[model samples]
Target: MNTKQSRIRRSRKTRAKIAAVKAIRLSINRTNSHIYAQIISADGGTVMTSVSSNDKEMRAQLPNGGNVGAATVVGKRLAEKAKGLGIEKVAFEAAREGGLVF
Candidate 1:
């Protein structure tokens, strides 16, 4: 009905599909002030790893957390963490104005 509700509905559908396949997911959340990313377990019960522009290391290198540059850094960091954990594949889940994108 409302925008938020619609978004949630879409996300639920996407997540359901991902869960059905039992695939690890790389989820991303963006705010006006920061970008956050995480690797989630197949069951979606655990967060394997996470990275954000607000992290101490990122904050030190980036004067502003709300920008494409900061988002890139966060993405790179998340990728590194995933690789270190032996994660080679993931379903990408990112929020977009239209809906959640995979």
Candidate 2:
């Protein structure tokens, strides 16, 4: 399989395992210009919270929304939102399956 297809296959498997345990997940997605983060329900049926560099508030504070600084802001914003929702724990999914750690 190609790189993109392989990554998808790996992520599906990892997500299946996480779903089996019904654990909240912290998912992140990075594009060429922006980074986005979200807290997803165990069943993957809903997104509990989300943050991204493209947000209006974030965009105003960050001169360049695609840099690491912007990503850091998004991450912190997501964490604060999760805490407010009473979500104290989450499994982090890296770029894709087998990417660094969970």
User: Which is the leading candidate under TM-score?
Assistant: 1
Q: Candidate 1 lDDT, tens digit per residue, 1-102?
A: 999999999999998899999999878889999998888999989999999998888999998898988887787777777778888778865542212124
Residue-level error in angstroms, candidate 1, position 13: 0.5
| lDDT, model 2, position 7 | 93
Displacement of residue 67 (Cα, Å) in model 2 is 1.8
Weakest 10 consecutive residues, lDDT, candidate 1? Answer: 93-102
Instruction: Report the C-alpha lDDT of model 2 over 11-97, residue by residue, as the tens digit.
Output: 999888888899988888898788888889988889999998888999889888778788877877877787788887788654432
Residue clash pairs of candidate 1: none
Give the number of the best model, judged by lDDT.
1
In model 2, the Cα lDDT at residue 48 comes to 93
Backbone clashes for every candidate come to 0, 0
Compared with the true structure, the alpha-carbon lDDT of candidate 1 equals: 0.81
